[model samples]
Target: MPHLTIEYSPNLGDFPEADMALALNASVCASPEVKDESDLKTRFVRTRHFQIGTADTPRAFVHAQLRLLAGRSPKAKQDLSERIAAVLRRMAPRPDGTLVQLSVEIVDMDRPSYVKESLG
Candidate 1:
């Protein structure tokens, strides 16, 4: 299973969370390294209190943390990270004066320690 968490500064203004989730899910599923699209889970967290570069001016950032099962090669992970950043950057809102930064981090989970159960 792959879990993606998005954290952003609320000062960036209203964000289309649903659209972002859908777009990110599609991006994650596009990668061949991801085994199942159904196993992907995504969520967004908005931060109200955050400082950027010690500046009082308005600055926005979108940070995505992706967690996947351990096994993928370093190159695969790097590619996935780049793809994710591209998708996010394309969708991120950039106001005339606000500086927006997009970033992604990929983390591997220990297969033995990771557990999942679904009942339908």
Candidate 2:
């Protein structure tokens, strides 16, 4: 776990982002590359107008982007993505009137570097 961006609809309410971050960190730590929890970084963004018309009322959608700074492997990325997705799915509310959607994308740091220092 290095950097994780969790984007969701503003309708999610004022939930505990910190708790989510911690859970994500713990999940990543289960991986080999995530040797230290200190190396993890996380961010949550709640935006409005992120609706799914196909779904019924009371909809909720969430997109998660996870960037790993170490131990970049295809298996690792797949595993992490699935794990994160599962976690988010369980944590997210149901689409009673709210259509709940969740997706997770994992990025490997070994290739295509995009760190702050590299950006310059």
| Model 2 poorest ten-residue lDDT run | 111-120
Per-residue lDDT for 1-120 in model 2, tens only? Answer: 378899988787665687777787788778776777676678888785765776466767789998766556687778888878877876765644556678888776664454443234
Relative to the unseen true structure, what is the C-alpha lDDT of residue 10 in candidate 1, on a scale of 0 to 100?
88
Clashes of each: 0, 8
The superposed Cα distance between candidate 2 and the true structure at residue 38, in angstroms, equals 0.7
How many pairs of residues in model 2 come into backbone collision? 8
Give lDDT tens digits, candidate 1, residues 1-120: 999999999877778789989988898899998778899999999997888898588788999999999999999999889878987888887877988988899999999989898887
User: Which regions of candidate 1 are displaced past 4 Å?
Assistant: none
Model 2 misplacement above 4 A: 53-58, 69-71, 110-120
Q: In order, what lDDT does every prediction score?
A: 0.88, 0.75
